[model samples]
Target chain A: MKIAETDPFSFKEMRKALFFLTFALMVLGTWMTFFYAPTEVVMGHVQRIFYFHMGTVWAATVAFTVVFVASIYYLVKETAKWDTLAYCSAEIGMLLLTLTIITGSIWAKPVWGTWWTWDPQLTTTFILWVLYAVYLLLRSGAGGRGKKARYSAIFAIVAFVDLPVVYISARIKRGISPVVFGPGGGGIDPAMMQTLLVVLLGFTLLFILLLRERIRIMNMETALYTRGR
Target chain B: MKAKLKFIVPLVIIAFLISWLVFAGVRDSMVYYITVEELLEDVPDVYGQKVRVSGTVVHGSIKNELDESLQFTMADGKEKIDVEYDGVIPDIFTDGVEAVVEGSISTDNIFVADLLLAKCPTKYESDEARYQRKKG
Candidate 1:
C-alpha cells in the first residue's frame, strides 16, 4: 500500500492498459492472419497456420530469454524477486513452446506428409523443451528456497545454450524445417511478412500480460509465506 | 562460495554429459537426408539399407499406377533416382518440389519408399504471384 502510494506510475493502471491492448492486438492479428494475408501459392490454406506457429515460437523465445537473464540476475543479486521472475517466465515459456510444437505438428501432418520427424531443428527444439521442463521440475522438487533457487538458476543459464541452437540448426544443418528469415533464408512476400509481424507483436504483448499476472501472484505468495514465518 | 561449489560441480558434470550425448547423437545422424548424388555414389554401400534421400521431383516424371502406387524420378542437379512409393503422398508433392523418401534401394536400383515427405517452398509467395506466373 505504501509502495503504491510512493510510486508515480501506478502498476494497477499499467496492467489494465496492457490487458486491453493485448486483447485488441490479438483480435486484429487474427483478422489479418485469416483475411488480409494472401493464401500461399503452393501450400494453400494450411500455410495460414504459419502465422500462429511463428507467433508462439517468437513469444516462447522471448520467455526463455527472460528466464536466462532473470536467472543470472538472481544468482548475482541473490534476490527472491529475480528468482520468481525466472520461474514464472519459464512456466509461460514452456506453455508457449508446447503450443509451438503442436501447431508445427499439425502443419507438418498436412504439408510434410508426416506428423513428426527428428530433423535437426525439430530435435534441437525437443531437447530445449525437455531441458526447461526439467528445470521446472527441479525447481519445484527442491525443498529449500535458497538452495533451490541457486541450483535452478545455474541450470536455467546452462539450458539457455540450446535456444540459439534451436534457431540456427535449420540453417547450419540439413533439416526439413525451413529457414524463413535470415541468411540463407527464403523470404516471404511483403503481405505475408506484415501478417507475421502483427501476430508476433500480439504474442509478445500477450506474453508480457501473462508474465505480469504470474509474477504478481508469485510475489503475493512469497509475502504470505514470510508473514506466516 | 564453498556451498555454491557443491552445486556447481554436479551441474557442470551433468551439462557436459548431456552435451556430449547430444553432440555424438547429432553427429551420427546429422544428415537428415542423403542427397541423390550421395546415394547414387554410395549405391553399393547403401543397397538394401534403410536410408532417407532428398531430391527435387523431376518435372513430368510422376506417374500414378493402377494400384495407387506412385512412381517419380527424383533429381539433384544431374543425378537422378527412380522412386516408387505406395504410401499416402503429401499434398504438396509435385514437380520441382523437394521430396525426401525413406526406404531402401532394390537390387534393380529403384528406391522403394515406404514414407514420402515433401518440403514446402521456403520462399513463400502470394496467390497473386502464383496467378501471374501461371498466366505468363
Candidate 2:
C-alpha cells in the first residue's frame, strides 16, 4: 500500500479535505470552549482553557499511539516507510503534547495555585516526555539502522507502558473505585460529556489529517535524498 | 502480536489502575475561583475549603497585625473581599494591582490566603492615560 498520495486527483482533494477538517475542528472546539460550556460557575472565562487543553491532549494521545504502532511495524517489516511515519508522528506528537502540557500548566496556575502537581497523569506524562526525548536523541546520534530501530523499538515498547496506566487510572477512579483523584471521577455531567465527546472526535479527525500530511512530506524528502545520492 | 502483548498487557493494567485515581483527584475537587460577595453568601460552608478569589486590593485595607498575619480587602465589580494571609505576600502585592488569593475563607469572614499572586500591569495603561489627557 502507498504510504502517501501520489495521484494528481487525490493529492489536491486530500490536502483540501485535511485543511478543512483541521480548521473546522479548531473553530468548533474554540466556540464550544468559549460560548457553550457554562463559565465554570466559579472560575469565570479562564476555565475555557479546559476544552483546548483536552483537544490538544486528545490529538497527542492518538499521534503517540501511531508512533507506537509504527515502531512495531517498522521493526517487523524492515520498511523505511514505517520508520518515516514513526519519526514524523513522534516529532509532531512532541510538539503538540508539549503545547498541551504548557497550556495546561498556565490554566492550572490560575486555579490550582501551583504550575504543576505530582499527580499521576501529570507525573506519568512527564516521564513519557523524557523517555521519548531520549529515544529521538538516540535515533539521531545512533550509528546504524539495525541498532537504531532495535533500540527505539525497545524504548517505544517500554515508554508506551505509561499509556495503559493513564487510561486505567482514569477509568477505575470513575467507575468502580471511589478514589479521590480518578478520571471523570463520579463521571462527567451530561453536558460536559457531550461537549467533550464532540471535541475529542473532531480533534481525532484533525490528527489523522495531520499525520497524513507529515507522512507525505517525509516520503517526499526521502525520495529527493535518494535521487540526489 | 502475542509476544508484544505479553509485555504490554500487564503494564497497561497497572497504569490503568493508577490512572483511575489520577482522574478522580483532578476531576473531583477542582479548585474554584470566586469574588468576595459569593464567598460571603456561602459563609462557614466554605470554611477550611480550597478556593481562589480575585479582586483589587483596597488602598487602605491592609493591616499587618502583631502576629505577623496580613489582612486586606479585595474588590471585584460590586463585591469587596477581605483576606488574612500569614505567609509572605508576592513582591507586587501593593495597592490596586488586580490580585488572586488562594486558600479558604475563615469563619470570621476573613479569606485566609495560602498563597497570593498579583497581576502585572498592562502596558496599555499609559495609552489609556494619554487618551484621557487628549480628551480632557
lDDT of each: 0.91, 0.68
Using DockQ as the measure, the top candidate is: 1
**Local accuracy of candidate 1 as per-residue lDDT tens digits, B8-115:** 577668767776666666767578898999998987888899999999999999999999999999999979999999989999999999999999998899999999
Q: Give all TM-scores, in the order shown.
A: 0.91, 0.60
Q: Residue A163 deviation, candidate 2, in Å?
A: 1.8
Q: Which stretches of candidate 2 lie over 4 Å from their true place?
A: A1-9, A168-184, B1-136
TM-score of 2: 0.60
> Considering summed lDDT, which 10 consecutive residues are worst modelled in model 2 chain B?
B120-129
DockQ of each: 0.61, 0.04
Worst 10 residues of 2 chain A by lDDT: A172-181
Task: Write candidate 1's Cα lDDT for A90-186 as tens digits.
Answer: 9999999999999999999989999999899999999999999999999889498999998899889889878877886787788899988877888
- A1-229, model 2: which lDDT tens digit per residue? 3644555457777779778877887788667766665544334466567667777877888888988888778766767887878878888778778878898788666544457654455665786688778877877884766778766765765576666555554343211111222443333334555567778878888777878888888789768978999
Q: Considering only chain B, report the TM-score of each candidate against the true chain B.
A: 0.80, 0.62
